[model samples]
Target: MTQSAARPAGRRGQRLTYLVKRLEMAERARMEEVLRPLGVTLHQYTALSILEAREGLSSAQLARRHVVTPQAMHQLIATMERDRLIERRPDEGNRRILRAWLTEHGVQVLKECHRAVDDVEERMLSRLAPEEAVAFGSALERCLESLTVPPEGLARHGDRTA
Candidate 1:
């Protein structure tokens, strides 16, 4: 059993999940401060980064990846298009479906955001030794996978539609 699993129930503050959530909140605050000057919210930065990696994704696809509703993603895409950070064109396969890609301006902005976010990440990881940092990331990935992937004969969380 894990250290947390072995521990007797106590204050909620003592839980590992609580500590992880606190860390996530702190990191998000720091990222927001850094990104604010660049006129990018965390959501926008994430969408831009995803578009850079996988161009031509529809808003629905982006929504699924973002774990948000398609309507929300549509609003975000519209905002980005207004900012000239992304362009949408009709898909060749389906003229009705519009696919999104980053513009040159978007790429430049994303690069700047990347550097700023990297600094935030570096600061967050500064306390850990290099090896410890790697292990921590691996452990977090395992934890995420355990939650996201359902056990055999069980339906996934929030997968009722599927």
Candidate 2:
């Protein structure tokens, strides 16, 4: 019996992993600096922002959009409810379904989050020209298309060849 090389391109895969970890750390540090004073984690801030935009969304829908589990979102909603940040009410036409909406407090917090987010974006991209920023973002979104994955970590579309 023989074992194939664990990774045919072992050094390249190691480089990829290191790059991902570095990026994740950098993003988390930036978000923490912006959000820590607001008393909301990045995920929580994101939830509030989404509710502010959509007003009312089911937990499932929120989870799908936020890339969180339904259970995780339920817990987050419970915390937000206790804080009076959001209110959940049964859908009028679908009594079985509950929609989450921003309370006045939620709106206020979202406004703060937006300001913080804007500050961060402006600082991060201030050196870029407007057209260059647009081009950079468009290119990033194209890169993101391949990053989307199913719950099981399988690519939803495109070849996984690497």
Q: What is each predicted model's overall lDDT from 0 to 1?
A: 0.89, 0.80
Find the 10 residues in a row with the least total lDDT in model 1.
153-162
- Model 2 C-alpha RMSD vs. true structure (Å) is 6.1
lDDT, candidate 2, 1-162, per-residue tens: 245453233345655446657756877788879988987778888888888778789999999899999999989988888988899999999999899999888888878978987888777678899999999787566556656654354444543443
Which is the leading candidate under lDDT? 1
Cα-based lDDT at residue 23, candidate 2: 55
TM-score between model 2 and native: 0.73
TM-score of each: 0.86, 0.73
lDDT of 1 by residue, 41-139 (tens): 999999998999899999999998888899999999999999999999999999999999999999999999999999999999999999999998987
